[model samples]
Target: MSGIAKTPEPPYYAVIFASQRTEGDRGYGIMADKMVELAYQQEGFLGVESARDEGLGITVSYWESLEAIKNWKEHSAHKIAQDRGKAEWYAIFSLRVCKVERHSFFEM
Candidate 1:
């Protein structure tokens, strides 16, 4: 099945993160790529979308369960990055997790 087909129907979870970086990203690009790769290898991870410009970034990741989301949150490397975000990388940020009961997409 395609990646889109694997997305769970209704009642899935999304982790939305919005951030403003503090300075030059330095190793951020590489780390972000690695993080995406790691997340895809994780059990229950559905998909991810990210975009950034002028020090602002947004990342949204889909998951199968709350437990999976929690596991990702507690991941050691992710925790280290989270600390870096708070202390040095990010000027401001917010994380929101929502239960998605329904969605739709169209392409032309």
Candidate 2:
């Protein structure tokens, strides 16, 4: 599953974050990496998958429950990163949270 995350089985939550970045890195790369590292330390974090090209990026992080998702959203360090994304990194972004009742995968 190369880029796909090997997440825990469903009845899980996925935080789908899609963003359009502004020109220049503005240290966004480092922040994004740090965010991933920090997320792994948080409880209920299952896995993460991300992709980006030409300033367009989409990241999906898996969690055991919505409460865990909420905690991640309110994390102090994550809050700082969010503020920076709004002020410097992203031109615009949208977030969607979905309960993964079903999923499928394939290999070739």
Candidates' C-alpha lDDT: 0.83, 0.91
lDDT of 1 by residue, 17-67 (tens): 999988877677777877888888888899987777897788889999999
Candidate 1, TM-score vs. the true structure?
0.88
RMSD of each: 3.1, 1.6
Compute the lDDT for candidate 1. Answer: 0.83
lDDT of 2 by residue, 8-106 (tens): 668899999999999998788898889999999999999999988896889999999999999999999999999999999989999999999999888
Best by lDDT: 2
Clashing pairs in 2: none
How much lDDT does candidate 2 score? 0.91
Task: Assess the local accuracy of residue 16 in candidate 1 as a C-alpha lDDT between 0 and 100.
Answer: 93
Off by over 4 Å in 2: none
Candidate maximizing TM-score? 2
